[model samples]
Target chain A: MKLVPTIRYNVQDIITKTIPVYYGVFTLIFLTLFSMSKLTSLYMAGSFSGASFNSTVLIVVIGFVYTRSSFRYLTQMGVSKRTQITGKVISILLISAVAVVMDRLLELFAEFLFKSTEMTYEGSGIAFSLFDAYLSKLGPVAREMTLIGLGYTSRVMLLSATVFIAMLYVRMNTAAKVIVSVGIPVLAFVGMPALAMLIPEQMAKLIHTIAEITGLSNGLPIRSILWMTGGTVIFMMLYSLITRRAPIKD
Target chain B: MSSLELIGISKSFGNVKALDDINLTFEEGKIYGLLGRNGAGKTTMLKIIYEMLFPNSGAVHMDGHAIGGNDTALGKMFFIGEKNYFPEEMKVEKAFRLMNDFRKDFDPAYANRLADAFGLNIKKKIKSLSTGYASIFKNILALASNAPFILLDEPVLGLDANHRDMFYKFMIEKYSESPFTAIISTHLIEEVADVVEHVVIIRNGCIIRDEPRESLLDSGYSVSGKADTVRAFVSGREVLGTDALGGFETAYVLGECPKNDLPEGLEISRMDLQRLFIQLTNS
Candidate 1:
């Protein structure tokens, strides 16, 4: 529908602005890590480390920037807020997919240049630094790409949606904005820990339930992806609510 | 010939009412002058029509469909707003490329021609342009858009007299070749005095005056004479304001001239758009 053009415009805008910042931050961190690794390897034998950026930072940055100015630009172009919300989420999905690929390439390059990084497993059987771990077990190539892409996409979109909503929530003058801003820190700093202490093994039980539902220990990413997809939809609905009558700031 | 109607439109920010119960219709192909003083809800009205700011109540319609969420309908009108909404780093020509993506009827050749006329360098980034050139850049976009409706808010914000004259002439030329509804909001009332066919003046969040240029001009007449004679002549009529000095006074009267023999030393003159605006909007 109208989302097609909006997506094209937003994706272009997001990538044009986002990529440069992403690469700039990544290069600074990577080169600093490389120099540190070089200096450390000289003194300490068997000390090895290679750095690659967590593309989530880029997604978060782009999300903040979109709310900061890009939405104003698109809205000026006659884009509806609904279309903008949808377009931005889709843009994040595309950016995340592309960023994941680029990130993996850079990780591989970093590993090649700096040190060795093998896909290792913890005792719980969760794979980290994934490399060819699921090629034989995860069915066809397309399905694997879908699983991986959707996983990256959902994570990135979650951050993008959260950051966007948080930025926009500040724009509201409602009491709810004040409540959310005040309540979250209280919950994190004082309430959660107290709740955890009051209920025996409460935090452990919660994490265990989440793990079981995600099939994390069972090594099935589909359940986690389905949950992430559900989360993404919920965030989109929230975005639609906040932005239905959102005013472009002066 | 797209018709735009704002029925009972109202907007506010916090406790301040920006526009209140405003209704207006922009018929096709006629230029309108939207005149208001600073913070008189002029920009707010324009922003509301463009859906940049949602109204607290009422609706905006173009040919009967709600324009708030309709991009295709919204696309039919291009607004040359006061502020820079485009990304700061984008070059002037790149902005045209972006505009091309949104507005289908944007004439790149015509835009380039206008840019050339203004001696604007298309390669310069928008942020690097001076205020006058920035205004020129936006004006070029709006003129070349060929949209059925074009809203210009302070379109000649920083242009010199020569450039402003050139803009007015070219605006008329563009309208002549391909007609469209243009609503220009500005403080420089006298500049667009003859260029616009209709006048809409807002004051303190209300539409105080909305009428045709000729009728509005004819609605008021200023009389200057001896202070006593002026006061006597304006005794029965609605006098907007009066200026008095050493046995002489000038009284601005509203609602048509009295058809009577003028007393000695009493004279009447037509009220220009600017004077009419000043009289009507004086608060």
Candidate 2:
């Protein structure tokens, strides 16, 4: 199908589009925070205990904003929903991969070039580690990359699916749009706690199954692939169901 | 040949019924003027055909198959909607290229030529263009699209007199050379009266009149003279509407004109499309 090449092109477009927006916003934010931290370090010991940019969150937010703003425009240009779904999935994956690479490079540059120490906080205890510690402990570079790549890929896949699902209601009336925009996050946040309380036994059973399937190092890859595939199907169905008869509006 | 058939199409927004039981057919290679009053479901109908909005209860058929998620059917029809659906940041030239990419039949060269004729700067961002220029930008794309069917809703909106004239001329010129179906929904009935080959007059949410332009023009006429004479002449005929100026009266009548020429000062003239539209849709 033409979807293959169309998706390839859309992925390039999404990647091309994100770098400028992400870098521009992140640069301004990072510079402002860096200045504030340096000034604070004058009096206190350490304000910047290695700034851990939650780049996974960053990728998700980027996906959300892009899909929200561009879906109508893209569809109007004759891009089918199937192509859109496939393209977005590929784009989100590529974007997450790019972010991981950039993040790692920044970490290495900060450590080797600037001699900065990275820190891990275990509850109240703080432990220092070099940039190389992750690679050394994870195993061979190729295996470590597979595990880490799967982790990021799964996060991007789930997030992109979620963003697409939320955006499906964008053409609905103002009330529906608002409910979707505000309601989803509230539900997601509250649902976690609510689900735990409502179905303790079932939740424990599900966790046990997940744990059994994903035995830490040995099963992480399978778990990652499962989440990625599961998220894609679930969100695609949700989006198609709601938008099956949606009236396109400004 | 190709045609678009709307079978029992109906749409409603809340309690407001935008379209009701609209079953219409738009055939190939002719200009169709869809004349309707404001809020008469013109835009809604056009949007449904292009898949921008789905009808509440019925389907749009292209050729023989019902359209559903099939871009190929819609790809044959290009919708020139009133709203600017293109990305605000996209350049005008970029929009043309994108349209070309979507439809292989879209002529980028012809688009640029149309842009030049309209004096539009294709390099300018879509949002940066003035309202008139924005309409021109979209018009250029539609003109160059070369799709088998094109639905234009208020195509000349925001256009000045000169641009409007130019557009009409270009539309006719293009049609003569290479014929394509055009369903034009516009309030400016007089402007498109001579251009459209067929006429579809909609009132409220119902089809009031559907005929060829020649049949429509020949079907109705006006008789003006003294009030008494005009009334006597129009009596027993289908009076669409009447206008009075002091003692002078003119009655717009439908079907046919009286051939008897015995009246001393009674004057008869063909009812223009604009006047016919006004009377037919005047509630």
Candidate 3:
């Protein structure tokens, strides 16, 4: 009945669980890369992109754990399933936005540090955020907009994958769980690619068409944002269908 | 007064029926002890009432409104189960704060005081707690929740003697301060016998007894003496069970003791709740 507290609690939970690890790993990687730049003549680049990638991974993990962990805890607290699922959706969006902002901040921080310190070093440096790495040709405003779109799309895609897997795992028996746990990755990494080999041209065309429609091929991700938003809704509906009457298992 | 009712509730896992066509009601402002043997569906029934499990037929209602996915109705009840549901990395105090966030009446001060009384370090992560401490932590949360209905499944599962004693004391203190409905489902019937005002015994997924504690206890009496004397005294009476050791015997009989007609050799005593439960639910 009270949506705000549920959403607030879930957001706090996700942030408390993942954000610290994100920042810790970011600091470690940044320092490691900075020290390497100081010791060698090689140009150090792509640090911000690496941070963004890590954030995406963290979001994906959050999707799975939110269902596995928060769902159980909240249910025990007498939160209805609808409230839990709604909290989860809103929490994902909020945390994903936070991750995007953190990515942008990390980019700025890295750029300032590298550029100011380049005069003292033997090697030059460039800190390319995901946007710079992928869409450097876009103007300043377009680049920022594309970054927002890219962040939303990447998080939605990963969240869909992990939430689908986690929900199916929750609803399944031991044997089905084991099979699914082993089957999904194999299907994605080996089976799909292998099947694609039998129809390389069609697969290639499909990929290209997807990229074109999403505007990623043209260095703009505006359409991808709308498409991924739609994808998120569909994934959320599937999550609800799976969990509406689902009982908590041991 | 508010009441929680289960009408024709049934649940099954594969071929095993955990609960079957059961109807029950829990009235407000009273303590109820749900007595059942292992696999007698105490946990399953409680879970279904808490909406953690869905029943195959019928539904749970609070004040005549279906509680299936209704947040307002669900929010009125808080359930603490044997397993830890808090995030493993969450600290005890943080959990208290989170509870406060969710339940408007949650008393953080009371929870902290209870934590101090239990010697539970507020900073310790839930995963680091030993078995007894985990139970204590969950119990403390339930006691401080201030929800109208609190369901505890195996609330004393891992508690030692002293802590269990302290918990019962605190539970009574809290309930006296503000009366709320509590349904405590546990295997340790004796420990809760004095605390529960009402008793419900489940056997083979069906409720065989549900009544006030005094009435349930009054339905049986035990006689102990020499084997032959005890048997002779209980002869023609409704016998629930008997235990014999060497020349001594104790016969559990289903009826009030005729206090004035006590035989010379046999000693008559009120049957304890544990013995009654064991006799009634024994296969």
Candidate 4:
């Protein structure tokens, strides 16, 4: 069936309503830290990293704010829940992708303005190396483009997971919703690091094996990136399935 | 054979039963009034039909197809509940655009005309609109939906007299222009009595009266005279209700009063929809 109209409406709603509200809050925090001189360029980079890590969590929070009456309103207006859910997920991804791209571009611009190009590291760490291996299967130009695309896609998937989780919690009571909303990121932040530390030797060996198989050098960032990206994808899939069966309030 | 049908529908919240073994049917091209007191299962029935709420037992069907949560069945129906479902932050025009995108039969021109008629600002956010205007906006959306089976629960709530009149006029006009089945559940019986062809009154989660308006009116009569005379005249008849003020009395009787048998100084009139509704439901 033709799905463009529903997608367009949903995307526009997220762009105009959800994204602005979210980005506004983020911007306010960014400006406040910057103005206080409490956030140096290093802090900016760290915050961006934190944002990327919690991207799904951010999207879920925003989704919770908008999904209840907004989703129901669309349904009441004759849009099917399936169409709405699909459109919403796509819109969340698009917004997340756009936000990440904008942040990276802004970071590059800030580096140039601060005359800190020498101090800045453009390397993608293990993430870039693993991506480079896959990219090398294509040519050099294709590799660069694919790397950029993967970065963008990774960010989008993370955000989409958040939106899915938030929508899933739509039918939950206020306290339970807040718990789930806050719990996802807490689990991600605490759980991943704890897992990594607990199995550092095994993780290190796995990284070495991956590096050897990909013909990459030791200490490549690709292994870390793979772990993070794989975790994100798994989280997103689980979130989508949970939301598909989520109880909606009438 | 029926445009809409419900079979053995049952719903409960915790231990309280909202609907119990409810069965209803609606024919095409007729306006039905779903009248009920508060918490009498009218909204629950409508929601079940629209698939917003699932019946704990039995099924709802439309045109021989089950009205589940599928898009096909949902596309053929429309429901307007008491809640203002629009986002509080959305502008009127944006809301219209959203509606147009979702509902295939949405009439943008009609919505615009209603907006203009009601003096609703297209740029104003829904949260900013007055209560009356908010209801006006919702009514306009319902009117422009053009669905075959439209369920409006208290569509005239919070509307001023002028707007309520306009709403009725618009409903009649829309019905004439394109005949459709409409179920309007409202407590304002008199406001819609003239336009509605059928009346379905529910009391305590059961169908107490379901008949054509003409048939209902034909079966009941209002007798007014001196207290003693009216009481004596109505004593042998099925008395639905009685209202006695000082020495005068008016009794609403359920059966026909023959023209040949006239009680002295007693005046008898045909029961209108409002009186019939009051007499039948007051108990």
Candidate 5:
């Protein structure tokens, strides 16, 4: 009944599950790169970083996996469906922020290591943060703040969408589940390409219009941030609707 | 004192009606045995009460307010069913800790004590536990929950005889120390016949019997003797059921045995809960 406690408990649960996965992936990536650097004499010439993108993917997966498990467990513990959603929403926001900050810190650390080793290595060891690679035109402070906003909004939007998909899967029957599972890839890989081929000019115009609307065509990501924030709100509302009366399945 | 009431509740899965229009009330502090045969809607009713499954035509209420997924009303009850709702990787000790964090009344000391008594390894992940230990893990939480109401669906499933006995004993001890309502849904009727103060028997999605345990037991008596003798003695009476092996027989008859009429070579004893349940739900 205590809303704060329920939200706190869910946030704790999500973080408990997320920490190990996040760190494990980071460790794996670091070990692989270290091994490659020594064994194959691999050298990166330009900005070699996808921390934001990788972290976004990981957070999306964490969202999907925890939705079913947490919903069932919390409901069994007498937490209401509404409370569960509220808890999840807060957790998604908190985790997105944490992931962004952690990724930035790791990038700084990587840059430090690369700079120190640059004199000894044969090739120039340079690393650029995601913000510097994409938003070079902005001032330092503006770039950092915009990147943080972009990270949170994008991660929240994608994770909320993933959570919604997970809830939908839980609600689906076997036949419907099969249909959607097969339908999505077919639509993405085969159907869309065929349609685009049938109407090349129209499809090209549509893609261009969409890119412009989402602010991907422009260098400044301010409009994209607004788009992503709107997306987060929409996806979270859908997620809440699906979860409100969701039954605990056997 | 509080009461949980179900008013005209019904549920269906496709064409198969799981529960019909039914009304039941569970008071604040009595142990109830929700006995039914397999697929008799006992679990369905419990799920509905706990808000795990919504009823199609009715609502569940605590005191006077409807608890249509209300947090405060739901917080008053805990339902431990056969399903393992905990994350697979969670250890038993962490689960107890989380329960403590979730419920104000949750008693961690009691949970740890129960876990030790059951010889459950608190360090092991839930997925690593056997079926019986898993049941023990959940039951321990329910016992230590200290909520106003606890619903146990097949609480003793997969439990060995010794563990089953331990669970029943622990349940009684907990109930006596600080009374709370417990609706135990199980097929093992005889085991809980003495433990449960109230008896509710459901048959084909309908409640056929609801009364005090003593009155239900007093409704009938079992007479055992030669098959023919028992049959003759039970003639013209309401015979719930009868079982025979070789020449010997046991017949369950409605109403009390006539103490004065001592039929030769015949013996009468108290009704067997399992036998009564079998007969009542035989249809």
Candidate 6:
């Protein structure tokens, strides 16, 4: 069957209204990160440890804003439920990809302006580490592309969870929309680690063993990635099912 | 096969009954006006016919097949309500694109022609348009969709007289080119009387009067004269409604009034749709 025009229109709507807003926010985030990196260098010399905090804050902010805008557009368009959800998924992926690329570019600019040193390349740069890992698993070109693709997908899924949670309370009102937009990401950011700590010692040991097999570790970044991905996926799946059957008054 | 049919349909909201034991049928190539007062269950009936709301009991059928949620039968039907349901941020062109996608028979050229006719700006967002323009754009979409069965609920609510006339003219023009079934639910009976063939009057959640407009007009009569004279003439007759001014009284009575027996200065005229609707609904 041919794709419904509503889907195409909704996608176009996402590109027109949602993307620009997100790009604007992303620019602000990149600038903020750049400044923070500089400040960290000035204070601690070689120890710039607030990178994770900056990245998390930026991702959550962008994700929440985009999700709220997307939901409003989808509902107002009178798009069917399936198209709304699917269009949102596609939109999230697109925005997330742009955000990831912007983040990397900002990192590169920081490295160049602050370090100001040229060195012989043994492998890809620090920003390319994720891409290199994916390359090692897949191949040279495919792996690099796949890593970008995966990063985009991961970001989209995580943001979709925020969209879904926000939707539960704000499906009908703008005030609720704002509340959920800010609430879900903050909860996910702060709540996941606390929940992880609640795991029993034996279960933690078992999880650690499994993490080793999967090349995961107790490293804060890896643990945070796992938490974000797992939580977002579960939340998104549940959200999708709920929204699929949600009653639409208009 | 019938173009549309509703069998034993019933619906309720909370404790209030919106529709009760309703059945309706429509053939192809005919225009029907669903006439009713506000809250007379006209919208509810239309919603059920379009499968937007499922009946608490019974079923709707199209072409001898039962209709359900997401039914293809709905593809053959276009339903426009009083509200502007299009995305607020959507441009007129984008709305057209959506119509073209969901409705297989949508005519883009016709839509554009109607847009030009109505002076609607294609680049304007739906929310930015005036209420009249919004109604015009929606009417254009309904016309362009080209669904076999078009159901309009107060489709001209926000339109000015000029646009309303333009809408009826366009409808007639389109109907002449390709005859299709339409059921317009509106309170503006007099305005649509010239084009509408059949009228279905609803009252208290039921079809009270469903007949050809011509037949209804032919069968009803209005008598106006001196109060005593009109009263004498209408005594024991089926008087639908009556109005009095000073000593003179005007009475709308169903069935023919004998010309020979009328008083000399008394006036006897055939009832029109507006009178008929007022008589039917108010009584």
Q: For residues B1-283, could you state the per-residue lDDT of candidate 6 as single tens digits? A: 4578888988887898988888888889899999989899998898777654557898888898886533356667777777665657779997787667666789989999999989999999999998788878878877888888888888898898998999999999999999888899998888989888988888878888788888878878999999999999889999999999999999999887576866776899887898888888895
Ranking by lDDT: 5, 3, 1, 2, 4, 6
Query: Candidate 3, residues B121-159: lDDT per residue as tens digits?
Result: 999999999999999999999999998999999999889
Instruction: Note the B-chain TM-score for every model.
Output: 0.98, 0.98, 0.96, 0.95, 0.94, 0.95
Instruction: State in Å the error of residue B147, model 1.
Output: 1.0
TM-score of 2: 0.84
TM-score per candidate for chain A alone: 0.73, 0.62, 0.80, 0.54, 0.84, 0.55
Worst 10 residues of 2 chain B by lDDT: B255-264
Top TM-score hit: 5
What residue pairs clash in candidate 4, if any at all? A60-A162, A125-A221, A126-A221, A126-A222, A127-A221, A130-A222
TM-score of 3: 0.87
Regions of candidate 6 where Cα sits further than 4 Å from its true position = A1-4, A15-17, A24-250, B51-55, B256-266
lDDT of 5 by residue, B97-172 (tens): 8888789889999999999999999999999999999999999999999999999999999999999999999999
- Tens digit per residue, CA lDDT, model 6, A1-250: 2224534543554456555565566456545655665555543233232244124455565555545444443333334455556655555555566656654554454455446322211212332443344346566576555545445545666676667765675444677667666877877886655666776675577777866643335322344445556666777676677666343344
The TM-score of candidate 4 is 0.77
Residue A64, model 3: lDDT of 75
* Residue-level lDDT for B261 in candidate 6: 63
Estimate TM-scores for all models. 0.87, 0.84, 0.87, 0.77, 0.90, 0.71
Give residue A74's error in model 4 in angstroms. Answer: 1.4
Please report how far candidate 1 places residue A23 from its true position, in Å: 6.1
Which stretches in model 1 have alpha-carbon errors above 4 Å? A1-4, A13-52, A107-150, A166-170, A173-186, A198-203, A217-219
* Model 2: residue B280 alpha-carbon error in angstroms: 0.9
Where is model 4 more than 4 Å wrong at Cα?
A15-61, A92-157, A174-250, B226-232, B235-237
Candidates ranked by DockQ: 3, 5, 1, 2, 4, 6
lDDT of each: 0.78, 0.73, 0.83, 0.73, 0.83, 0.69
| Candidate 4 clash figure, as a count | 6
lDDT per residue, candidate 3, A1-250, as tens digits?
7688888877775677568777667667666777777788887654233444346677767777776877788888889988887877777678878876766666565555566444322111212322244556778797677666676566766676678678878889999988887898999999889979999999899989987876556544566677777777888788888878878888
Model 5 chain A: weakest 10-residue lDDT segment is A118-127
Per-prediction DockQ scores? 0.53, 0.39, 0.68, 0.35, 0.66, 0.16
